[model samples]
Target: MKREDLLFLPISINVTNKKILLIGGGKVATHKGTIMARFVQNVTVVSPEFTDEIRKLPFTFIQKEYEKGDLEGYFLVYAVTGNHDLNAQIKADAEELGILTSVCDAPLLCDFVSPAIHKQEHVTISVGTNARDAYQAVAIRNQITNLFENGTLHI
Candidate 1:
């Protein structure tokens, strides 16, 4: 089956206290960590190099190359290292362990796609395009946020 044909069932998962492994510390990884930190407290980032922004985050940061067993004990994994080979390997490892995985820029290898999220108090809205178009998802999410702010779309 084609990657686009793969269906994603949208659902909310409770990540509080659940282990999360982030395999990268660059711009994309930083963004992912920032978003995840909002919902979960147990996030660990592994990478050889990290941006200053990521260093300031509260999550535990491991300044080393990702190892094979890094996915152990993690409930979810985000492979955003920008290295196709590394991301693929990470995806394979995580899937083998029966863990949910999201490989940045590689939807076919991912078990889940992180959506563009808009949060307003207790209400959170997410927009996604099955990893086909991130810009479009962000634009749609922004439009929805505007509508909510203007009281046009009441929850």
Candidate 2:
């Protein structure tokens, strides 16, 4: 489905204690994994090769290609492999296993879309673009974050 056909709602899921699996080791995985590692306590990233950046996270790293069985016991998964077919397969497997899934750069295959997020203390804000403009989404989130930082927006 195209971006216009998809509508992404920004919501928060309490994943502090849940298991999150990231099935890639490149920049996409590193970027998402870094954000996830901030709030999630249990995360496992799997890939045959890993970038030096992702290796620095406080999470388990498995140096191997993703197998379907590797998805077991995860509450959420991000399919970020460079291969579209592989990412699609991960989404299908996640659907079969009743796990929430997000496929990088492939909105049609994603059950959820990652949004630009800002979290501090007790406040968390997320901004999505309905699968449209990501840069604008971040820009909008930054504007809101500015208000929060300046004490203009408070809970």
Candidate 3:
């Protein structure tokens, strides 16, 4: 997943009114939900178990195992299941419905891969590497941030 592989992706979404479905209630799911809720109106999280982090969120929680039917009528689906098989099935289901989907740690099965992101109001920076050296990308991003801070870079 090089930067080129990222192609065009949404930098920000004002979740004033959007629906997002997050599958799994573990740490990754909670992190994703926190971000999604920052911009979307409704974020529905479906998972049989909820982490303490997840329990703190104010979104709709469906404390049940994921089913194929759970994908109905959602704008986006996130498959972050600890179970790879279930995650793949959710990805397939989203594909069948023509809905956007993100599969964590399974970028090969995703329509979109979440980029390493840095954000400020009205200004967001996203960097994607080949998923080979995430730390390398993070270091580069830090350099870029420093350049901007020193007025040596402009977008």
Best by TM-score: 1
| Clash-forming residue pairs, model 2 | none
- Tens-digit lDDT track for model 3 on 1-155? 44335544545544456678899999888888776655564888999999998878778999998988998988888998788999999998899998889888875676766656666566678776644455776787787788887889766
Q: Provide backbone clash counts, one per model.
A: 0, 0, 4
Ranking by TM-score: 1, 2, 3
Per-residue lDDT tens digits for candidate 1, residues 65-128, read 9998888899999999989999999988888899999999888888999999998788989998
lDDT scores of the candidates, listed in order: 0.90, 0.89, 0.78
The list of candidate 2 runs beyond 4 A from truth reads: none
**Every model's TM-score:** 0.94, 0.92, 0.78
lDDT for 122 (candidate 1): 86
In Å, residue 28's CA in model 1 sits off its true spot by 0.5
Give the candidate number with the greatest lDDT: 1
Cα RMSDs, all models: 1.3, 1.5, 3.6
Rank by lDDT, descending?
1, 2, 3
